[model samples]
Target: MPPATPDAALTSATASPQQAAPDAQGGVVLAPVAETPPKRPRAPARERTIGTKVAGQPAFVLHSYPYKETSLIIDLFTRDFGRVALIAKGAKRPHSQLRGVLQTFQPLSSSWVGKSELRTLTDAEWVGGMLPLEKTALLCGFYLNELLVKLLARDDAHPALFDHYVSTLNQLAHNEPATIVLRKFERALLKETGVAADLGRCTSTRAPVQADVTYVVDPERGPRPERASDPWPRVAGKTLLDMEREDYQDAATQSQSKQLMRFLVAHHLNGAPLNTRQILVDLSQL
Candidate 1:
């Protein structure tokens, strides 16, 4: 819950999408890439079911665990259906078709059929083309997955956030600054989850934030002038404004936003600890 200490707070996919390049204004911009549509599922008759089928759904495997003998319970982050739990029958079998298909950070077009909370995965195939995450980027990818698995609700849809997620992955794979990529995604995730508030103005006065003024962000509200007794992280108004514009060009914004987001995320989680966050903190990465 709050990273165990203030220092903990301070320590903090999709297709072959094109690399992200900064615009003339030096803002990161993702070039739109064409996505190859997923082919229809080809499965045995016995595996096919009519129970509310969703086919060719863009997705990534957030996490999976062994369920029974050779089976797995997969948590998927889908474009249209948010997070979903599916039973991957026989995935653990050596020759199972899904053995190579279900992997984290790899794009997939998943098909399933079921009305229950745990659906049956009928078919899945890797939608290749994107760069694979390596080294620190790989760990950062896991961190992103952890956040989605912990924060996003099942069956909820967040299309914009999903797109941004893809772009974030692309940036990370390209060796772009991890801190900036993560900060942007965290902000987007918080916004999509309906927790983030505008940081460009004061919650109390509704006046534009002055760059040099120090402020404290209220997770439930927005930013406000800091008081003597406030215990939250005190960030400069410039940091808040820079984060609002998704700009991390400034060194101060990078450091301050990290701590601010760490505190806010912990607040929203109601004191639940983020495992990957702790790992990143230990590694001095992120």
Candidate 2:
């Protein structure tokens, strides 16, 4: 059998032959000495961390408010970081670099740094490929931003939804029907947040929704069979399936889907009004 080797802990404590003393009987005995406890490996020296620095991330300014005399606190929807609040110092000053570049609905590559929920905006560069949303589309753009700010939690990234937002912006810029465009974005926003999904199925039965049957969206659940006295908007199951497919070209689908989505979003908001929606609705623009 191979001789057993001392553990590293024991090896560190082994005495030198010179340290052993001659006993009265002739055997060499080591004098008792305090055994050193194994040194706890010190945690590696922490690098002096200053702050979390993010650079050249794709984002859009959802909204910005005057933070103080010369600064603005911005609500930004970032592709990778979801919703973020950033303090753009000196942004309100006439000569400030961020004043023109921080416009809402414009795609921007922004850099920020800080450790708190509200970060410091270090830089912003416009990445202009899509056209600026104009006229009615412009209001619709603000509507989208309002919905996101209302629904999306900060620092929660929804990459798919972000891509959809960019696509919706492009579509709006190109003069796509606003009704369909807004409905699609609303549906997608809900789906991304797990507030709505499986729109083509029924909530109670978990069965495939029939095209001809009327239903009401439960918001928490998917869809429920419409009851006689139900006040919520009743939508045909076909309309629900059309929403699932993102198709709203048909007049009935277009009209019915709008009411359904409006109810669902309102339910989730718990009567909190969408400002942009109110503006568009007041003007009979949407």
List lDDT for all candidates, in order.
0.91, 0.88
TM-score of 2: 0.83
- Model 2 lDDT on a 0 to 1 scale: 0.88
Alpha-carbon TM-score of each model against the true structure: 0.82, 0.83
Best by lDDT: 1
lDDT of 1 by residue, 180-274 (tens): 99999999999999999999999999999999999999999999999999999999999999999989999999999999999999999888888
> For all candidates, what are the clash counts?
0, 0
RMSD (Cα, Å) for all candidates, in order, is: 25.6, 7.1
| Worst ten in a row by lDDT for model 1 | 8-17
- List of clashing residue pairs for candidate 1: none
Q: 1-286 in candidate 2: lDDT tens per residue?
A: 6665677548656753335789999999877656667997765332222247788989999988898899999999988888999999999999989889999888999999998888899999999998999999999999998899899999888999999999999999999999999998998999899888698888899899999999988777778899998888889989989999988989999989888888889988888989889899877655
Alpha carbon lDDT at 238, candidate 2: 91
